[model samples]
Target: MLIELKNVKKYYRTGKLNVKALDGVDLSVEGGEFLAIMGPSGSGKSTLLNIIGCLDKPTEGEYILNGKNVERLNDDELSEIRNNYIGFVFQTFHLLPEYDALFNVEIPLIYRGISARERKERAEAALEAVGLKERMKHKPLELSGGEQQRVAIARALVQEPLLILADEPTGALDSKTGNSIMELFCRLNEEKNLTIILVTHDEKMARYGKRVVHILDGRIESITLN
Candidate 1:
């Protein structure tokens, strides 16, 4: 398994009340699987994604990613895992407005202290993979919504991460643009055998995954195979 979450729970203490963001959630994902997590607002889907992505640790339970038990890892350890193994795509493109696509895509590698020559090459290849090679020199404001998202995807891919966690990746786009973005995801999953966990409320978007996991009230309510 690429990911395993056993009886995971995340709770936040808000004065006298404890909010259960995830309650005894159990989920396992095999390598190269495209899984969608569907949920309504305040349903804990984003919190679940956050845990899986190592952006936050569960309050209790086991989380094993690529064979390492990560729930109890130190802050630096978790940061290393995030930098070396995982990629994240958010609803907001989160691109640097001042930089061009190529530079934005090179940011991760720069943090890793990779050579400038190699970073440029890898960023170029990633942009090509996302069908945005021609826009490599364009700034975020110069691109359309779909194009900006493509740049974000390229930035994620530049690391060649084992897993990609996309939180409402298509939420900011029009239906047609969203469909195109999802199709791009499909192509990447098929062509690169990339493992993708997409969190979205849209059923149309969830259907693109090989398996759909529906979450409600901090628990998984159903799992369906496409």
Candidate 2:
């Protein structure tokens, strides 16, 4: 399995109250699988995604990613794993306003200590893969919503990660643009064997996945294979 969560739990302390974000959630994602998670706000979907992406730790239970127990890894180890193995696409795009498209895509490679030449080359290739080769010099403000999202995808791609974790990837785009982005993801999954775990509140968006997992009140309500 690419991801495995066993009886996982997460809790948040707000003032004197303790809120359980995840309650004994058991989930798994296989290689090359395109999975979608859907739930309303406060349903623990975001918490689950955070744990899977190594951005947050679980309060209880085990999280084994690619057969390694994540709980055993230290913060630095976890950071390394996240940088090398997981690619994240956020709803906000998260691009730096001061940087152009190519520079934004090259951000992750800098942390990897890649040579300047290699960084530019890889960033160029990633932009080409996302069909944004011509926009390399354009800043985020100059791009459309769809184009900005594509730059985000290119940034994620520059890492050549084993898994793509997208949280409401199309939230900022119109329906037409969102559908096109979904098509791009579908193509990537088929052509590159990318494992995608996407989280969204839209049922229509969730339908794009081969499998769907629904959460309610910090627990999984159903798992549907399409």
Give the distance in Å from residue 158's predicted Cα in candidate 2 to where it truly belongs.
0.8
TM-score for each model: 0.99, 0.98
Q: Model 2: which residue pairs collide?
A: none
As a whole number from 0 to 100, the lDDT of residue 82 in candidate 2 is 94
Task: Tell me the TM-score of model 2.
Answer: 0.98
For residues 1-226, could you state the per-residue lDDT of candidate 2 as single tens digits?
8889999999999999999999999998899999999999999988999999999999999999999999999999999999999999998999999999999999999999999999999999999989999999999999999999999999998999999999999988898999888888888888999999999998989989999999999999999987
- In order, what lDDT does every prediction score? 0.96, 0.94
31-138: candidate 1 lDDT, tens digit per residue: 999999999999999999999989999999999999999966899999999999899999999999999999999999999999999999999999999999899999
- Which residue runs of candidate 1 sit more than 4 Å off their true CA positions? none
Clashes of 2: 0
RMSD (CA, Å), candidate 2 to true, equals: 0.8
